[model samples]
Target: MAKFISFAISILFFVSTASAAPKSDLWERWDLSNEASDVQVSHAQWSIFLSKYAAYVDPATNTRLVDYSAVSHKDHRVLKAYISMLTDIDPLSLNKAEQFAYWVNLYNAATVDLILDNYPVKSITKLGGFFSFGPWNEEIVEVSGEAITLNDIEHRILRPIWKDKRIHYAVNCASIGCPNLYVEAFQSSKLESQLESATRTFINSDKAVQFINGKLILSEIYNWYAVDFGDEKSLIQHLLNYYEGPLYQQLQSYSGEIEYQYDWKLNEKK
Candidate 1:
């Protein structure tokens, strides 16, 4: 009887531990392992909803409260879903290391989406006004069982663990000046690819920068995060690697822009 009782207790312990263990990730929704080519995903969903951005936006209010009942990127419904998924789910519910990665990436991605929800504005900073204002400070963007602020996710988690500089590109601030808004959601598996692509895409655009007198005029981003790109004297060298063209030599010779002109206007969906 004693032996039987001991065996039963052991079995119960094993079962409990198994049940409590984090879930195995059977699926990675997004994959961009192939670094040879730039990855592109569908924007049809976002485009469809954004087509009506002009109709729903209220200029006087300078507020963007569109129909996000659905999970449409353009409609901004995905923002709410992302927040819901992040806040309600348990962290330990996922496997240990994966849990942290998932948390940080989700925090970064969802924050961008939520900020964009109050979209149709000229600038993300506008959301915050002087002397005390702005929704960004609201804090506690609930997501995946986590109640965290943008500062928490950015400074605390992402900065500490991930040393990669491309994170700057992945986390959009939602102004015309910010990196181009990605349509689909960001998953861990696709993190590297998304970051690379965002960096290349943004730096290549005319809004943030322009090619002047054969010189590579860069956005303030390069200036602000010059050290982040790579340890090089010239900030322009970092961008040239991604930009492969006849102008490569030209960029090296001339990476300095006379000045930068970032569009404070909201990336309106007109």
Candidate 2:
């Protein structure tokens, strides 16, 4: 009986870990957009909030951390208001660039708002009840009369619609292992440049790639959303696109096994 129980526990653990990385499935409703429309959604409130709270802790790694403990009650309300404003906007009315910026900013702003609401926690994975891994699956907002979760915004809308690998860098999970949350809100006019910058910043950082003991260590993001990055060879090619200097040469020469690691600690300011 004891042996069987242990076996069953191991199987359960495998199932849970396998299912933790949500697949990139389309939600359909968010697929709608106006390519010709010039409608713009304002992210000024989110920008202001980021400016006040977000800071670079390590210049070498470009790790941007948020001051959750320092957020005043008034600023918290402002952050909430920013999310509310995003929820109220009709995403279908905007052009492709605007829509891209909208979803990325919304995902990021909502994530920050969630952390602030549940501040003092060691990690984001601690919230959303016992059966939950994190708040990603929780219905945190409503858009176009349908409830939305962080998972939906990312997997359903952003990934399916944009099909840009850089989307991973733009949508933060409020964790140290995740890509750095930009200190500024994404704007439509600067969306391409922002995405490019984010991709470059993360790819070059140790969080994305590291060479340890002559082996390749990559962020778990690559493994979780492997489809977005393609096979191992393709992934290396992708990395090479952003890597630079000695690291770039090392990546080109290395042909060993790839290992993945992630840190789920809250990316809070010290």
Candidate 3:
């Protein structure tokens, strides 16, 4: 079975990488093709697994801690099945909204699967690959016969196609510095509301923006995806959309250079 799966993935990687055409600075929208149509893609299986094992330390901080050790053997099998179901669905056949939800959920799910397969790791960055520390660049899943990686889903597909800064919130890296993973799987029906809520919630968290020595220290995500949030002034405006209280007032009054930091510790439950 493992050999068969490996052969299948090899073919997918060749096809997906070989047929790629040049993309413009902007990615084309999904569901724009003449053959595109709506299709049902269920995330129930993933939601069930999450509800059984995921939890937030405190609602106020939105710090999620996944009980990796608590995940039983049966649940792992269920997760593999969910990933298989997602892989079988042709994302090109789904509408724009469903496509967006599909990629986000798939990325998050794949990330979890990677961590689970190598449980007890202190950090995701510990999952070393040929050229990098983390396995982000590894093509761990295939969809519609196209082998895809976490980086491909986030950078190549979601980020460029949507051009929405809120995407950084929706996709979690299973790290303490990353945004909290949503307990419920993202669905096409609630895509808009979920995206809005994710953005608002993350910005309101101390991880998003905070003061240190009177300097505004932001997440390295904003720096890494600087273009996604626009200029520093514009990024501040975006944060103000959800930030409040004394820090909000401080951000409003203080105008200087902003620094960034990130913690790669696993978001595992104690």
Candidate 4:
């Protein structure tokens, strides 16, 4: 009876954690994009919001924290307006780069709005209900008359459409362990460099990779999205692409077990 109870608990734990990471199933509607189109989506309002609220809390780690509690009523309305503007735009008419930037900014703006609506909470996971891990599954916005959840923007739209592992770095979950929310909105003109910078900043941070007493520890983002990164060896290679300096050398020499962890605490300014 004891052994059976232990096994059942293990299975329950696996299910809970695994279910939190939705698989990258393609949403065919979002697959439509014009590669040759020159239209650009304006993220000016979002850029203004980010500039006012997001800041680098830790220079050494590049931890860009958001001031959720500091958001004014007027600024909150501006955020909603920004999201509404994005919803009104036809992403299919824009080029692939524009669409990418559009989705990323929309996802981030909506996430911040969600947190503000439920401020004074200790963590994002606290708002999503008893069985829910976080608000990712909640339908927070509607684009082109279709209601969309955070998971849809990430797993269904961004991940499947781009197939770039860096997509993981671009989307923020409003958590300390996740990549910093860009201080400026992602622009189509600088999307490549922005993604590259986000990836490099994250991989070098202790939140993403840490070597403690000879053991290699990584973020749960890597473990949850392992398929996006490929097998264990492939994962290391992917990390190497962004990792630099002495940490780069440490990773090269270390052939050991990798452990993964994540903190769901809100990435709020102190």
Superposing all C-alpha atoms, what RMSD in Å does each candidate have to the true structure? 16.8, 2.3, 8.5, 3.0
Residue pairs in steric clash, candidate 2? none
Taking all chains together, the TM-score of candidate 3 against the true structure is: 0.85
Off by over 4 Å in 1: 1-78, 90-120, 132-135, 143-147, 230-234, 255-258
lDDT of 1 by residue, 159-257 (tens): 444546665665545455656555344544556676677677666566444677665555666555555555444456666757655556666666243
- Where does candidate 2 have its weakest 10-residue lDDT segment? 55-64
Score every model by TM-score. Answer: 0.60, 0.93, 0.85, 0.92
State residue 216's C-alpha deviation in candidate 3, in Å: 1.0
How well is each residue in 15-79 modelled by candidate 2, as lDDT tens digits? 58734788889988878878899777888888888888896566755578998999999999988
Model 4 per-residue lDDT tens digits across residues 203-239: 9889998988989999999999898899988988888
Worst 10 residues of 3 by lDDT: 18-27
Best by TM-score: 2
Angstrom error of the Cα, residue 95, model 2: value is 1.2
Clashes of each: 11, 0, 0, 0
Full-model lDDT, candidate 3: 0.80
